[model samples]
Target: MPNPIKVVLVEDSAVAREIMQRLLDSSPEVDVVGTAQDGIQGLDVIAQTKPDVICVDLQMPRMDGLEFTQKVMSDYPRPILVVSNAVHPSDVDNIFNLMSAGALDFFPKPTSGTATDYEKLKSALVTKIKVLASKAK
Candidate 1:
């Protein structure tokens, strides 16, 4: 079997981080190797872990996601999947801007309030990560 994809999650909210970790753990093809609470810590973790994919939050403390994405793209150029609660239609332009800046794609914060919500999003997340990771390779 192919090696499981290594993922580093960088999210500030405790609940959101736990939810994401749980979802990622459910995937057989993916592994949550490390996690960070902010962009600075995320950067450190990325450097240390060298994960195949990094899931980051846009509004983190100590260095927001956009800045981190810019730096990572400029230097590391790894696959970055942005997770955010900014789902308003008005934010589409800004989201596009993030995509242009570096992030491969963005996903809505899972709010299903149950395991089913995570199960649905997990499939999409895994597909996205696999595609991006393959391209990065």
Candidate 2:
């Protein structure tokens, strides 16, 4: 069988972290190797796990998502998916900036506080991670 897609989630919110973990756990093809509460911890997890994908929150403490993304791109060149609560149309420009900076995609934070919020985008997210991970390899 093919290797499962290993991922690391970097989210500061306790509720969001649990929900994301549960969502990833439900998918047999995607394996969440580790999780971090902030960008600093996320960096440590990434160094240890070298996961195929890194899902990061935008407004984290210690090191915000943009800074974290910049560091990862410069130092590791890994596939990154940004998760944030900024979903307004104006935020599209900012999201595009992140994409230009190295993030492969952005997903709006789920309002339900559950992984079920990811149901609509899970397939797409997985596909994008796979594609970007291949490029990183």
Best by lDDT: 1
Report lDDT (CA) for all predictions: 0.86, 0.82
* Clash-forming residue pairs, model 1: none
Task: Compose the digit string of candidate 1's lDDT tens values, residues 5-104.
Answer: 9999999998899988988898889999999999989888988899998898888889998999998898778999898886344798768778888898
- The CA-based lDDT of model 1 is what? 0.86
Clash pairs, model 2 backbone: none
lDDT of 2 by residue, 1-137 (tens): 78888999999998888877777777778899999999899999999999999999988889988889999988777889887886344787778777887988777664453455477556666676677668767
* Over 4 Å off, model 1: 87-90
The TM-score of candidate 2 is 0.85
Task: For each of the candidates, give the backbone clash count.
Answer: 0, 0
Off by over 4 Å in 2: 87-89, 113-118
Find the candidate with the highest TM-score and give its number. Answer: 1
